[model samples]
Target: MHMLKKIGFYIVAKFVPLLVIMLTTYFFSRWLTPSQYGQYSLVISIASGLSIIAFQWINVTLGRLIPKSSADVKIKIINSGLILYFISSILVLFLCFIFGEFIEDNFKTSSYLIALLAVALGGFELSQRIFNSEERVLAFGIFQGIRGVVFFSFALCFYYTEYIYPGVVYALIASYILLSTPNIYKLLFLRKKDFIPNSIKEIAVFGFPLILTYVLLYVLNSSSKILLTVMLDETYTGYFSLGSDTVQMIIISVMGVVQLAIYPIVIGAYNKNDEDRYNIFSKSNQWVLLILLPVTAGFIGISKGLFYFLLPEEAYLRVIPIVPFLIIANLFVQLKSLIFDYAFHISKKNGKQFLPVFCGAFTSVALNVMLIDGYGLEGSAFSYCIGCFVYMTMSYLIGRKIFKYPSIDVGFLFKVTVSSLLMLLIVIQIPNDSIFQFVISIVVGALSYIALITTMFYPQLKKYINSNN
Candidate 1:
């Protein structure tokens, strides 16, 4: 019952933020035109790209050390991570200053906004890493929930201002500052005695490789949008980002909550000498597959109506056609981030993880360069999917060998695949003319899936219950 309550809290935490994000997206999709939204998306993407470069290494270092570190050492690691972030942020700001003119012209955004976005983004993310490592689910939930509400409130205020898209960036900066205040306040009490100068060097040496790995991952996700904007225009970029981001939201709403609920246990167990950690990791991966695979299929099944409801008619037409590719690509990305990449972390072979991401980014960029000129949007979308596939599968294949993780669960795979196919067939056959019909079809499909899966698991469920008795 305690576990159940903890899981419930994590869900509320992730769901409130996710719901707010979806609502904001829905409103913004129509309130702002494709061009405006595309530019706004581009601004956020660029800021994210720069921020990861600054924070990824520190993120990797903390993820590895925090789960097992003593209290004093944990303070050292956090303070060191902050120091690294500060130095990196300063470096990033300098680069932005030098490239301010080019950025302003190319991205339709200012260097000032980008820098603020990077600082806020890095701070917020660093705080979450601490929360995740410490297994502070309630704190994680509270902070994330607060950030979402603050963001939405300020976002509405700025949307009507003359600043428009840039106003949205300001709103984000404000929310991040507000949410990270408690984290920042706590840091002030860390003693200078705890700060290790060599710890900085160790973290730097270990985390440097991950910087590129993260940049490659970012490339796998955002390179397409960047290239599309350059080769085509903002409208096409907007269409692609909308489909991709929507699929991402759904994946998070389903799989992310499960991960949050279980991730602390998995990390915590790994810090001690125990065989149970692998089992926990395997079970979590199984949950990811069981939930996401079917959700991916069903998302594609109802994507037409979903987009129609969310986007303006003109944008809907362009977005729906590419959503399948977007869905496939996003599934792989999430799977890699949440599950497979942990193998590299366990082995402390961060460099080995780099190759797959590098290759994936290379493939994505090469394909985009080749395809965008000839086939345009569809071409770029296809490239994104293929690149993600290469990255995800390669990471699993390579990581398992470096450190043996669980083998593929064939029986579970078959069960979910069958259920997903059945759900897909039932959903597509249903007429999806209005949002009302869309809701009904989704409900029917979900109920049908639940019924079938429950039956399939009945034997195991009974056996488990009998064993418990």
Candidate 2:
């Protein structure tokens, strides 16, 4: 497939479902009370956090190893991964069972049930990663889209029936079960192989460090919710979660598409010691910033208007102050993932990757604890922005020292930043008193950004367009 077409499919595939899920939550928040929505968010955060600890390393390992492996070795690696997943799943379940009461008290639910669902969801996610590593972009996109559609459809039904939170849980479990089926078949029936102990050990050694890294990163991202739930109440958590989740959906969708599409190419180029690797890495960052910068700015500029359209007035008002901070925080998070983190991966200095995230996570936790008591939800948002800034700064410094990819074009970056800022100024000046104005403002901002980008890089853009054509 042509690289551009592949990237387009990947982006559309990921973006559509993410958009659906975000919209679903937006509607769900309206139907459910703040406390109820907060509980739902808490459930998801806990499940996602646990899943990261249990399954992230496996996911990372597959992405790192599968592209370089022979067909037979790929099968072996998959088998090894399956074995590890089963073992880890069982262990996690046992631990959940052992601490069921503590878990129940903390999340105010059945810990065992949430644990079981998380394991199932983690399995589905791991399968998706496998497909991604194999470069089965269509399959990856299709199954992910299916999960989003099924879950949203079910959740909608539950919302109308007045069983919002429990219904969401059931919908997710069912959707993930359906989504996991194909990957299960691929692993167990068509390409089944005996477990390879040596392969398992190799994957373990390569992946364990990533587990800690991801856990700290998750803490950095999620500690605000946890602190809010602790310091104030679930209602406060709900407000913060709503803002953070909204921004996160946008960030993850864009970053996921870019990372999934480019990671293998980057790795392959580096492995072969191709000089083109530098150009590929540099251009990827440039393109990423070009898209992400304006999107982030636009989100910040229109957040008040957009949230009012999507959420109840009270709920929307509660989050207005923090939305820009969350958007900025998420932007930093995306930058770290795409550029700094990948540098460590390419250099095989995975261990060094953990330190910066650790520092950030520590800062996040400390600041949330201290600030939430005084500043409320806004404090949490500010802490998150600070933590992420620290993480990005540290990662860039460490990554440059360990292994440097090509530097991004400062002149191009300046142009993109200036253009995006101009769009933000234009967007913020638009009256957000109604939905029509809100929509028009977004359209105008986007078109203006595109116009500026074209003017700034017309020759390169024209050449690329002609080549693709």
lDDT, each prediction: 0.81, 0.83
- TM-score: model 2 vs. ground truth: 0.91
The regions of model 1 sitting more than 4 angstroms off are 1-7, 98-109, 194-198, 269-278
Each model's TM-score, in the order given?
0.91, 0.91
lDDT of 1 by residue, 1-469 (tens): 4445656777776776777777777887876778887887888898898888888778878877777788878878878887777788788878777777665465434677888888888888888887877778677767777887888788788777777676777888888877667657766675677578888898899888787788888888899999999999998888887887777877776676667766766677666553677777777777777777788888888888788878888888888878889888888888887788788877778889888898888899999999998988889999999999999889988988887687668998899889988899999998888978999989988898888788878898799889989
Q: Worst ten-residue run, lDDT, model 2? A: 186-195
Q: State the weakest 10-residue window (summed lDDT) of model 1.
A: 101-110
Question: What lDDT score is found at residue 15 in candidate 2?
Answer: 69
lDDT of 2: 0.83
What would the TM-score be for candidate 1 when compared with the true structure? 0.91
148, model 1: CA deviation in Å? Answer: 2.7
Candidate with maximal lDDT:
2
